[model samples]
Target chain A: MTSYTDKIREISKRLLKEGKVDMVIGFTRGSVPMMHQPMFAKNQGDVDRFVWDGNCGINLANYVTDRKEKIGIVAKGCDARNLAVHIVENKINRDQLYIIGVPCTGMLDRHKLTASVAGEIESIMEDEAGKTVTISGNGFSETYDRAAVLQENCSLCMHRNPVIYDELIADKVPEQSENDVDRFAAVRKVEEMTPDEKWAYFDDLLSDCIRCYACRNACPLCYCPTCFVDESKPQWVGKSIDPTDIRIFHFLRAYHCAGRCTDCGACVRSCPMGINVRAMTKKLEKDCLENFGWEAGLTTEQRPPLDTYKPDDPEQFIK
Target chain B: MKNLLEHMGIDPGRLHFSWISSAESTKFVEVAKKVTEEAVALKSKEKKYMKTKPKVA
Candidate 1:
């Protein structure tokens, strides 16, 4: 609920002005202040434009891959997780990053909230303590529990605190409980299905796929500049949109994201088809938690479960 | 019954079929198309449908 813009900007500007950081990365108010987008700041002027709120959706950590030099960045809880993975993979230099940790209580479900209102957000203001939301229309204002309209994933967030950070501005956030992880019930329904029924479900889901890799692109873990699917050298999933290849692409994505994913739910949000894609990751995430006791993007020291092998490791995949 | 993929100009010889056979009447072909396209795309150029030579019976 803390809009740490002034603090972040102040720090970022100081860093930039003093040459401690080459640039600062944070959220900027979008076309309408209701929505927000990322901004790469070089100086105080650019830093002044940075803001943070629920509407800041995209995982800006994806931008840090393959970059050099010192950079200060504003990180949400999810962004912090993604950054941790990057650090573990040696894809990012942690020493170079001045992470300004921002605690997100949760985000507003804009789609549902907009419909609840008069289809327009007249104004949004910080609550007295700066820890709640107050939506106003012309002059009529309503203050409610901030947790009510959070995004599905945010509501069920397990990693709300920045796993990696140089500075934490506000109070330490709370840990996520098992109940915070959703999509288990939906996954269970599928698990109870017969083989044919499962195939039918996948068939229905994949058929709706237009071969667009929005799910891949939205994923912060999917940072490979040139992905295998895009490999013309040995074309993995072609542009043909053939059912099998499309199906494999989906599987490939799921498997690739398996232990590497932070369960940020970007893949679901960005999907044009709205195939309940989060359901898959959520299912996989639950399995990872229940079976392996591993959560992705939580730490740089802990290897992604799939990548690291131990002779003593439980072989659940054993026949 | 005419195959759902028949109108899609797919090569049956080069194709792979995944049937989501169910007890009830919910056979959706639109979903079938997605799997079909993916199988076709994922089938590498080096890997051909190995047609078995018939034994002289």
Candidate 2:
């Protein structure tokens, strides 16, 4: 893992010095414990600030959307997948990119970590092996296996290596085996409930939403200049954080990401309220995979499932 | 959603409708083949008309 970080810096320096890219977008050590911030490097001096650890969870692909600069980006499995999505959507050109692919093990779930810890985390140190994280604060410290604290999406991730890349920092890690857990069990549970029960479930699930739009801002696929929430000509959705408005916002956000979302978990991670926004997107992902046999960002040539439909697509819900 | 995209000038072939249950393997194959054929046809249609469509000044 340390070697990978060194390789990233070395490559980033070369890309910048040789004028291969105008900028390199990667993670820097965050001011807080267990948090890493996205930083841009324009020169070799700036490349020294790059960091890669369990906390580099935020999707760096979000920074590449619609940017004209010849850029170098550090991408984990999900981030790389989203980058592929950006190329296919024409938000960014493939030629403009120098992807530094990182085969990710998984990202640590901050929410779960906080829940597991009783006090504030003074500092967190991840093992060089990327297997365990030691968190210390408030006169106590504990080390836990990295897997126990993995983000929900990462735990269920099937693609842990970059689907597309200009260069890989390390050997590609093996993808999580399907026998780990039933990824869609929660969605299946929701499906088993009655209509009213399902409605009640979502209502309770999303009741805490403040409508800050952090999730939208963090998503790589949500590059629409005018999001449905901002449309005033028809006023598709209300601006206020009304329950109905929140539901509408989540619905539209999920719908917009229907076939393109790689389940990178950026939206879930960015949400201040710790809402599982994937609840909506996961169902859509399942539908896409099961019905259309489509997984986002696998190839640049293949069109998204929704964007190119078959004459006989699943229409069980349609009259 | 399909209706809205079509209303915005997206090709109708981009939207498809079919039904297949988990138990129905034959139906899934049949539907999959039909969809692929339609998609191919639609692509050629788009290419043929792309040159003929009048350009907006």
Top-lDDT structure, candidate number: 2
Among incorrect, acceptable, medium and high, the docking class of model 1 is incorrect
lDDT of each: 0.70, 0.83
In candidate 2, stretches whose alpha carbon ends up further than 4 angstroms from where it belongs are B1-57
The regions of model 1 sitting more than 4 angstroms off are A1-3, A32-34, A110-145, A179-183, A203-208, A316-319, B1-57
State TM-scores per candidate: 0.74, 0.83
For model 1 chain A, give the 10-residue run with minimal summed lDDT.
A310-319
Model 2 error, position B27 (Å): 27
Best by TM-score: 2
> What TM-score, to 2 decimals, does candidate 2 have?
0.83
Per-residue lDDT of candidate 2, residues A190-293 (tens digit): 76665446656776888889999999998988888888888899988767665656776887788899889899998998888999999888888877788788
True interface contacts reproduced, per candidate: 0.00, 0.02
Give the DockQ (C-alpha) for candidate 2.
0.03
The local lDDT score (0 to 100) that residue B19 gets in candidate 2 is: 62
